[model samples]
Target: MVLELHVWGPAFSLPSIDPKCLAAIAYFSQAVPKDAWVLVASSDPSVSPTNELPALKNGPTWVSQFRNIVDYLRQYSDGAWDLDSNLNALETADNTAFSSFLESRAQPLIDLSLYVSSQNYWQCTSPAYGDLLQWPNQWLLPPRIHSAAKARTAHLGLSALDLDAMEDQRKRDHSAAVAAGKIPANFIQRPRDTVSKLLGRTSHQSQFRLEALTGELFEPLEAMLGGKDYLVTADRPTSLDCLATGYLALALVPELTFPWLRDAMKSKAHSLTAYTQRMRHKCYGTAAVKVADAYPSLSPSPSPSHLPWQTPERARLATVGYTLINSLADNTPILSSIRAQNRLRQAVESSKADLSDVEREALAKHATGMKKDVLVSVAAAVGGVVALLGYMVQTGFFSHEGEEEYEEEEEEYEEEPLEIEVGEAPDAFGVMGL
Candidate 1:
């Protein structure tokens, strides 16, 4: 059977495509007994005018993965891949048990994707995924990662990759190459060096970097699946593994081109890079899924005892959280505007006269107790300007109206005594009291 796999997203490029993911597709395509075709379809509104899939260069396959437009296509296709659409269908079918089970497995993954999508709309919908996790006795988040951390010492390899030396060397080489009018030592080295320098200089500081926080999030999944071959066959690759492996390869790049992260995980060990490359190929090509002989043993101890216990998953989660917070601090340009609006709203609301006496006293006490806390939290989020602004807004400090109210008395100007109207007292200040 000829198989065609399509990627429905923003754009298409082999390098942009995760090699592992492509490898998995390639593997599956080759594994099929008869000739099979592979294709990519980009649903990005701004698709390049010149894009042409080699496989589909011949003709259309009548197969597609339309994301938001799932319903229209579902009428014709036997199966649709989107989890949201599938869950919606299941809900309609009213197969409560099956729907609940699928939801339990899929919603967390969806929530994680939304969190990492870095778009505002994603966050708006992330909470909805909570409905899938609901149960009478179950907690919102599974304790799988927590328990694994208490039991396992394995690190999720949260250490950032240091490629500064490579970057420094590449820069030096480029400067030399430019001076010498040569191709920069080696032909392949130029692009490799360029990528290294570019990635190394950029910091990983974005909401989407949460995708790399896989260790913690994958704990329940790993526990449920155990250590098993993830593809269709021991020797053949699967689309799911391709996605996973592809994402991992991108996340684990040695150079840190992504700004939301400090760096990537690096090692002098040949086997480590080799393993990554192998995984990449297997997921992206025709290579079969095979367990590496030298997978790292679980660590005996965790890093940073004060943070959290050392489960591979916990470490992963911590690393992701750190990257996200760091990104918010360093990269979020709109944060200041949002914060200013929030502060302004708070000031105006607090000036209202609806407070009960008890509430007012409690608020005062809370304000007193929170002096240090406020300084730290607000300062961190909005900087020293917050304190000044808060004071001015809260107490009417620095306000023009308040300052004008205290204008110097007329005594300073030797105000001329007003001539009273005929038969009227000197205190009469208006033309007519009537």
Candidate 2:
């Protein structure tokens, strides 16, 4: 039977927005024969047993997550499709270690770029999700992903990168300025010049922190990759290479509103950038030409191209309802907690079964993210109910006992639009990438 790999759909002209999904794509592209399998960008994670994307299916059997999928694929064909087959025992162990290291170090950085960065998320990442998902999913997935990203990167102390956090800071600064009663200078501004300067400092600090983070991930990888096209051997890519390519390609490829990740990769580690392009072509073919086009400076010469893989399955009508149901289940307080608890229990139980340490950590992270999501959803639901009640009361639609109801004419007021400067300053990463 033909294998079916169900994953998140294309975004930013890449096969998948998710790194693990991209890793799976790369693995399949290199190892499995073209006719043996087909990719289904179903985008509905609910189909998987784990209710996660990047699920590989071989008839009745299924596997989720990147490492698990790789392990499963290798075992499926008597090592025929094993990319790491050439590696010795020690090399295989290193492969696993480096893969985990790449994930643990690289994930938060990716999160910071794609989700924590306000402008990037709104303008690029969220819109990509919108394109990949159907109606209700478009409404639901991005914010949860953003929340998860924030939680993952919370240790980095980079709340300044968040749009909501920044907006709140601006509001607090305005309040502080007004409270100080200093009509002193730059008063009639969205934020005073002084406040802007403060924001600029915070922005710089965040940039520096992000640079440090990028170095922590890329530097070691670059050293490990010293003069080698692939991570292990120059002959061909192994599982470790697939994992590395998945993470590095996303860092180098996507043209985000915040180009810090891409810029940092190009400037800080040229070899890694070139390695990513090589892997990209090997895995994605012409579909990844945009990756080269995005970084034309790095790739000045014309690059070879080949026929792209078949287009993935589009999100269908059923996907909309499926996402809605899952979203509701995920948001309901007690129900969500129970689900998360159950998931964690399952992860624990499956520790011995087949779930690798990285995949297990991911599942645990999902549980943590679910708790936060439930809290947010509860607050939103409560707030919406209160707002509806207030609207009804004001409109005299819902009368209160022992209270007079009256109608009043709505007054018109001239108000300029609230223009937000979503764009960062031109010299954004000036002090960083050293």
TM-score of 1: 0.26
Scored by lDDT, the top model is: 2
lDDT of each: 0.35, 0.78
Q: How would you encode candidate 1's per-residue C-alpha lDDT over 13-50 as one tens digit per residue?
A: 12222232233333333333223333332211112222
Native-vs-model 1 lDDT?
0.35
Evaluated against the true structure, the overall lDDT of model 2 is 0.78
Candidate 2 to truth, TM: 0.73
**Model 1 misplaced regions, further than 4 Å:** 1-15, 18-34, 38-61, 66-213, 218-227, 231-237, 258-276, 285-434
Candidate 2, residues 25-89, lDDT tens digits: the string is: 89988998888887776676777888888898888888888878877887889899999888989
For all candidates, what are the clash counts?
A: 28, 0
lDDT of 1 at 427: 52
Q: Judged by TM-score, which candidate is best?
A: 2
